[model samples]
Target chain A: MILHGYFRSSAAWRVRIALGLKGLTARQVSRHLRKGEQAAPDHLALNPQGLVPTLEVAGQGALTQSLAVLEWLDETQPGPRLLPADAWGRARVRALAQIIACDIHPIQNLRVLQYLKREMGQEQPAIDAWARHWIATGLAAFEARLAEPAAGRFCHGDVPGMADLCLVPQLGNARRFGCDLSPYPRILAVEAACRALPAFMAAAPEAQPDAE
Target chain B: MILHGYFRSSAAWRVRIALGLKGLTARQVSRHLRKGEQAAPDHLALNPQGLVPTLEVAGQGALTQSLAVLEWLDETQPGPRLLPADAWGRARVRALAQIIACDIHPIQNLRVLQYLKREMGQEQPAIDAWARHWIATGLAAFEARLAEPAAGRFCHGDVPGMADLCLVPQLGNARRFGCDLSPYPRILAVEAACRALPAFMAAAPEAQPDAE
Candidate 1:
C-alpha cells in the first residue's frame, strides 16, 4: 500500500498511527499541502476530494477520507483492534473520533483559513482565534466524554484506539495554533499516554521524513 | 430508540434516512437549533457535543454523531444493509458519505456561520458564499466519485445506501444556501433517484414535524 499524506495533516497523522498500530507498512508519498500539491490533477485522480492520507491498497485501489481508510485498515488488517468489540463501544469510539475529525478539523483546515484571509479579507488574529475557538470547544466536549466509565488510560480503554489516534493529532494541531490546553487535562494526559507508545511516537509529524 | 434532532440538521437527516431505510422507527424529539435549544443543559447532558440526532436506544445509552449512530444502526439493526458487504465497497460508500458529512457540512454548519457573523464580523452574503464554496467544491468531488465504475443509479450501486443518505441531506443544504447546482448533473440525478424512494422521501426535512 502507498499512503499519500502530509506530515502535518491531522487526518494523515491519524492514518499513520493506525498503520503503525496494525503493524503494517505503506510506502509514504508526500503531497506538499502548503504548495497546493494536493489539488494537482494527478493527486485528485487518486483522491477525488484531493485530501491527504489516501491509502492506495494493493488490490482494493485508493481509499480516501481518513475515517473510512482507518476503518478499512482496522477491519482488513490482522493486528490489535483499533475499535472495541461491542457495538455500543464501537459507536462511542467512533463518535469521539468524529467529534475531532468532522466537527473540529474541517473548519480549521488550511483551505478554510486561506479562504478567510483571501476571500473574506480576514486578518491573522481573527483566523487564529477561529482556530482556537473550535479546538477549545471541541476539546472541552472531548474531555467530558473521557469522564465516562468507558474511558481509561486511553480514550477507550487502557490501550490506545481510534479515538486516541484522532485526539493526539488534534492536540498537536491545537498546540500548533496556540490554543490554551490548560482546560483539558484529561485530553493532555491521553495525549501524553499515546505519545509514550511506539506506534504513536513513530507516527508523530516531527518523526516523518516530510517534516521540514 | 429516540432521536433528538432538528428538522434542518443534515447530520440528523442522515440518521432519519438510516432509520427509514432499515424500517425501524424512533420517537422523534426536536431540538430547535436556531433557537439554541440543542445547547440546553438537558440536551448537552445527553450529548456532550450538543449536536443532534442523538440516538437514545433502549439499552445502549445516547449515541451522538450521525456517522456513529448510522454505523451502530447498521450493525445492531437488521434490515437492508447501509454499507456494502465487501470491504472495498464499504470503504467506497463511507468515503463518499464522509466527503459530504465531514468535509462539506461541518465547514458550513449553523454554529460556524454564527461564529463567522457574530464573532468575525462577516456579513450574511460572505457567509452564504462560504457555504456555497464548500458545498460546490464537495459536490464536484462527489460527482467525480459517482463516475467511478462502482457507481450506478446511486452513489454506489442502484440502491440508496449510506452515501445516498448523506447526499440527499447535503443537496437540501446546498439548495438552502443558494449554491449553483447546475455543474453537478450526476449528483442531481442521484438526489432524484434517492428522493424517489419512500424511505428517503419520509426522511426529508420538510416531512419532519419541527420543520418551520
Candidate 2:
C-alpha cells in the first residue's frame, strides 16, 4: 500500500499516525497540496475529493477521509486497538474524535481559508481572525468534553486511542494559525501525552518526507 | 433510547432518521435551540458541546455527536446497516458523509451565525451570504462525488445510507438559507429520491412534535 499525502495536511497526518500505531508501513507518495498537485488529473482520479492522504491499498483499493482511513487501518491491522471494545466506550471515543474532526478541523482547513481570502476578498487580518475565531470556539467545547472523568492521560483513557490520533494534527494546525492555546488547558495536557508516544512523534508532519 | 433534539437541527434530524431506519423508537426530547434551550444547564449536562440530538439509550447514558449515535444505533439495533461491511466501501461512504457533516455543516450552524452577529458585528445580509457561500462550495463537491458511476439513485448504490442521511438534512439547511439549487442538479435529484423514502420523510423537522 502507498499513502498519498502532504506533510501539512492534518487529514494526512492522521492516517500516518494510525498506520504507525498498528506497526504497519505503507510506501509514501508525496502530493504537494500547496502547489495544486492534488488537483492534477492523476491525483484527482484516485480521489475526486482532491484531498491528500488517499490510501492506495494493494488489492482493496483506495481509502479517503482520515477518520475512515484510520478506522480501516485499525480493523485491518492487529495491534493496539484504536477504539475501546464496549459499545458505549466506543461511542464516547468516536464522539470525541468527531468533535475535532467534524466540528473543529473542517471549518479552519486551508481550502476554506483560501476561499475567504480569494472568493470573499477578505484581508489577511480578517482571514487570520476568522481562523482563530473558529478554533477558539471549537476548542472551548473540546476542553469542556475533556473535563469529564473519562479523560485520563489522553482524550478518553490512559493510552492514546482514536481521539488522540485526531487531536494532535488539529492542534498542530491551531498552532500554525497562532491561535491562543491558553483557554484549553486539558487539551494541551492531552496533546503533550499523545506527542510522547513514538508512534505519534513518528507521524508528525515534520517527520514526513514532504515536510518543507 | 431517548433522543434530546430540536425539530430544525440537521445533526439531530440525521440521528432521527438513523433510529427510524434501524427499526427502533426513542423518546423524543426537544431542545429548542433558537430559544437558547440547548445552552441551558440541564441540556449542557447531557451534552457539553451544547449541541442537539444527544442520544440517551435505555442502558447507555448519553451519546453525543450524530455520527457516533448513528453508529451505536447500527450496532445495537438489528436490520439495515448504516455503513458498508467492507473497509474500502465503508471508507468511501464515510468520506461522503464527512464531506457534508464536517466540511459543510459546521460553518453554517446556528452558533456560527450568532458569532457573526455578536463577534464580528456583520450584518444579516453578509452573514447569510457567508452561509450560502460555504454550502455551495461543499454541495458542488458533493455533486461531483454523486456523478461517479458508483452512485445510484441515492449517494451510494440505491438505498439511502449514512451519506444520504447527512445529505438530506444538509439540503434542508441549504434551502432554509435560500441557496440557489440550480448548480447542484445531482444533489437535488438524490435528495428528491431520499425525500421519497418513508424514513427520510418521517424525519423531517416539520414532522416533529415540537416543530412550530
Candidate 3:
C-alpha cells in the first residue's frame, strides 16, 4: 500500500496511528500541503478532494477520507479494533471522532487558514486567533462528552479506538495553535494514555520520515 | 425516538433523510439555529457540541453527529442499508459522503459565517462569497468522484444510501449560496435521481414543519 500524506496533517496523522495500531506498513508518499502539492494532478487523480491521507490499496484503488480509510482498515485488516463491537458503542465512538474531524479540524486546516490570509486579507494574529477559537470551542465540547459514563481510559471504555485516534491528533493541532488545553482535563488524560502507547508514539508528526 | 434539530441545518437534514430511508419516525423538536436556540442549556446537555440532529433513542441516550446517527439506524433498524454490504463499496460510499460532511459543510455553517461577520468583521457579500467558494471547491471534487464507475443512479449503485443523503442536503446549501452548478453534471444527475425518490422529497428542508 502507498499512503499519500503530509507529516503534520491531522487527517493523515489519524491514518498513521491506525496503520501502527493495525501493525500494517505502507510506503509513504508525502504531498507537502504547505507547498500545495496535494493539488497537483496526480494527487487529485488519486483523491479528488486533493486532501492528504489517501490510502492506495493493492487491488482496491485509492481510499480517500481519513475516517473512511480508518474504517476500511479495521474492517479488512487484522488489528486491535478501532471501533467497539456493539452498535451503540460504535455510534458513541464515531460521534466523538466526528466532533474533531467534522467540526473542529475542517474549520482550521491549512487551506482554510490560507484562505483567511490570502482571500480574506486577515493578519497572522487574527488567523492564529481564528484557529485557537475553533479549537478551544470544540475541545470544550469534547471534554464535556468525555465526562460521560462511557468514557474511560480512552474516548470509549478502556481501549483506544476511533475517537482516541481523532482526539490525539486534534490535541496536537490545538497545541500548535497555542490554544489553552487546561480546560480539557479529561481530553488531556486520554491524550496521556494514548501517548503511553508505542503505536501512538510511532505515529507522531515529528516521527514521520518526511518531518522537518 | 426524538430528533432535536433545526429545519434548515444540513447536518440535521442528513439525519432526516436517513430516518426516511429507514422508514422510522422521530418526533421533531425544533431548536432554532438562527435564534441561537441550539446553544441553550437543555440542548447542550444532550449534545455538548451544541450541534443539531441529536437523535434521542429510547433507553440509548442522545446520539450526536448525523453520520453516527445514520450508521446506528442502519445497523439496528429494519430498513434499507445506508451503507453497502461489501467493505470496499462501503468505503467508497463513506469517503464520498465525507467529501461534503467533513470538508465543505463545516466551513460554511451558521456558526462559521457568524464568526466571519462578528469576529472577523467581514461584510455580508464577502461572507456569502466565502460560502460559495468552499461549496464550489468541494462539489467539484464530489463531481469528480461521482464520475467513477461505482456511481450508479445514486452515489453508489442504484440505492440512495449515505452518500446520497449527504449530497442532497449539501446541494441545497450550494444553491442557496448561489454557486454555479454548471461545473458538476454528475452531481446534478445524482441529485435528479434522488429527487425522484419519495424518501428524499419528504426530507427536503422546505418540507419540514419548521421550515419558515
How large is the i-RMS for each model, in angstroms?
0.5, 1.7, 0.5
Residues B1-212 of candidate 3: C-alpha lDDT, one tens digit per residue:
99999889999999998888888899999999989899999999999998898999998799999999988999999989999999999999999899999999999999999999999999999999999999999999899888889999989999899999999999999989899899899999999999998888998989999989
User: Which residue ranges in model 2 land beyond 4 Å of their true spot?
Assistant: B183-185
lDDT, candidate 1, residue A76?
90
For residues B1-212, could you state the per-residue lDDT of candidate 1 as single tens digits? 89999999999999999999999999999999999999999999999988887989886589999999999999999999999999999999999999998999999999999999999898999999999999999999999998999999989988878999999999999999999999999999998889889999999989999888
lDDT of 3 by residue, A105-154 (tens): 99999999999999999999999999999999999999999999999999
TM (chain A) per model: 0.99, 0.97, 0.99
| Candidate 2 TM-score, C-alpha based | 0.93
Error of 1 at B89 (Å): 0.5
Ranking by DockQ: 1, 3, 2
Assess each prediction's global lDDT (C-alpha) against the native. Answer: 0.93, 0.86, 0.94
Error of 1 at B75 (Å): 0.1
Candidate 3 chain A worst ten-residue window by lDDT: A42-51
Score residue A189 of candidate 3 by CA lDDT: 94
- Error in Å for residue A152 of model 3: 0.8
